[model samples]
Target: MARADALEKLRETLINRRRALVRSATGELNQLQGRSAKTGDLLDAVAESLQSELNSQLLEAESRELTAIDDALERLDQGEFGKCEACDRAIPLTRLRAVPYAKECIECHRASVKRRSHPAATINRVFDSYQRAQ
Candidate 1:
């Protein structure tokens, strides 16, 4: 298929996915809110609070994904949809198929993952070093 046609298809898919995600997230949040209002017992209140926290985290993640989808749609409008933002290389159709909102090519994405140093990794390394020194 032509690049423009592919981009249009991807744009439609992302928009639909975004709508579904928003609806699901909204329904779940509403359920949690309703449940929280009726929790009279301490344990029930605690459980509802935990559920609400988890729902909030999930909603946060969904919101981020929604933002990415929106950005991809904007990029489609700008005629830069399939190009990797990091390397300016054409992102593979396969990758775009797998992740409609992907911003970087596989190689650039892998390099970015490699370059990142997580706090958990640092903490683990420090603990291992301290254990070895004992």
Candidate 2:
């Protein structure tokens, strides 16, 4: 398909996803707020607390995705969608379809993930260097 057509399709997908996330988040918020802390016993209270925590985590993830979707929409409007932010390369249609809000191409995204996953290693290397200098 043409580039414009592809982007339009992705835009529709993003909008639909945004709407779904909003609906889900709103429902989760209402449920979280409407739940009562008081329960019949300690076990029930613990279960309620665990459920509330899980809901909070899901809501947080949804909120982050909503922000990313909003950013992707803005990029689409600005004629910058489907381009990797890190490498200035056009992200593949397949990747875009898989992750509508992806900001980087596969290579760049993998590198970013690697970097993120090895922060402790980086820190250890730095410490080793500092120790050698001392």
Candidate 3:
């Protein structure tokens, strides 16, 4: 398919996902709010609290995804969609299809993940290299 056609399809997918996330988040919030603090027993109370915590975490994740989708839509409007934020390269269509809200291409994303996973190790390596050069 043509690039424009591909982007339009991705836009539709992002919008649909955003709507679903919003609906799911709203339902979760309502369910959490409807729950009472009082329970029949300590065990029940603990279970309720755990469930609430899990629901809150899910809502948070959904909120993050919603924000990503909105950002992607904004980029689309600005004619910047499917361009990697890190490398300024055109992200592959397959990657975009799998992750409509992806901000970076696969290589950039993997590097970012590696850095995040071992910041201390990366810093140590950098320091060691600097020391060696001195």
Candidate 4:
């Protein structure tokens, strides 16, 4: 069916993207390491070190995204593609196209981002529920 075809297309896209991310991250890490070997003026050395640190952080983030892409591929193989992991609803094609590795539908994704950005509120809500039980 069309859904299956779409899922397959998305799967291919995710695989290709994962490959590109890995290649780019590898190149960045290599450049950072190689560039660190050179000695320079005090200010230049400081700046280079800072840049290397930033690149390392970015590469780490890319690694996390690579893991997500792999998980999406696995889900596609299991016939669970195109469904939100959080709510079990169908993820829109637009979202899939925008983020081929997305595991949450748009609504759930928004709620998740809100929860992450407001940990204090989440904790307070949990504490309030506990108080109601007493």
Model 1 spans with C-alpha error above 4 angstroms: 117-134
Model 3 — TM-score against the truth? 0.84
Off by over 4 Å in 4: 118-134
Q: What digit string (tens of lDDT, one per residue) describes model 4 on residues 50-101?
A: 8889888767667777777788899998999899989999998987876777
Which tens-of-lDDT digit does each residue in 69-123 have in candidate 2?
Answer: 8999999999999999998999999888767888889899778878787332332
Q: In candidate 3, what are the lDDT values of residues 69-106, reduced to their tens digit? A: 89999999999999999999999998888678888899
- Lowest summed lDDT across 10 adjacent residues in model 2 is found at 118-127
lDDT of each: 0.75, 0.80, 0.80, 0.77
Model 3 CA deviation exceeding 4 Å by range: 117-134
Better of 1 and 3 by TM-score: 3
- What TM-score do all the candidates reach, one by one? 0.80, 0.84, 0.84, 0.82
lDDT of 1 at 65: 69
Tens digits of lDDT, candidate 1, 62-120: 66667777888899999999999999999998878767777888898768768995332
> In candidate 3, how many clashes are counted?
0
